[model samples]
Target: MSFRNFTTGQSHGFGGTYLKLVPGEMLVYSDVFDDPNLPGEMTVTVRLTAVSVGTEMTVVQENVPDVIPVEACYLGWQDSLRKLAGLVEPEITG
Candidate 1:
């Protein structure tokens, strides 16, 4: 799926297909980011492990673009995951 960046009005987000998925277990996908400065593609892997109290979700984004700083991406992902966890975890907990 293609995503647009509202801030920059750029279609610099992911546009790809879902490679694999196993409910409550794992997911894999590929995406292309058409960054005007650093266009590239990547594979994203999400793994979920069940714990006694909750599920542990891990995200691995591979094949990063050289123009994009890994540290900035990491921080962005952290914020995204935090928001996602807030949205998803409560449903599972309830």
Candidate 2:
């Protein structure tokens, strides 16, 4: 997937194939950055579980390159998940 930093006008992308998929239950994929500086293949796993209120999601990433800081990666995941929730969750109006 490709992404751009609106604030900095920097853009980059990664592409990978799905290693495993269990529709609505789990997903496993590998990613390789387009930038040569960030050289490494990263594996990502996502799990979903139904809950009382909604679905719970868990994400785990492995083989992240040493160039990227862990905190930045975490914050990026948080931001992405927040945006995802905004898109998937229903809006309530009083």
Q: Against the true structure, whose lDDT is highest?
A: 2
lDDT per residue as tens, model 1, 4-28: 5467886654578899999989999
- Per-residue lDDT of 15-85 in model 2, one digit per residue for the tens? 99999999999999999999998898999999999999988989999999998889978888999989998
TM-score of each candidate structure, all chains considered together: 0.72, 0.86
Question: Candidate 2 regions off by >4 Å?
Answer: none
Superposition TM-score, candidate 1 onto the true structure:
0.72
Top model by TM-score, which number?
Answer: 2
List pairs with backbone clashes in candidate 1.
none
lDDT of 2 at 24: 96
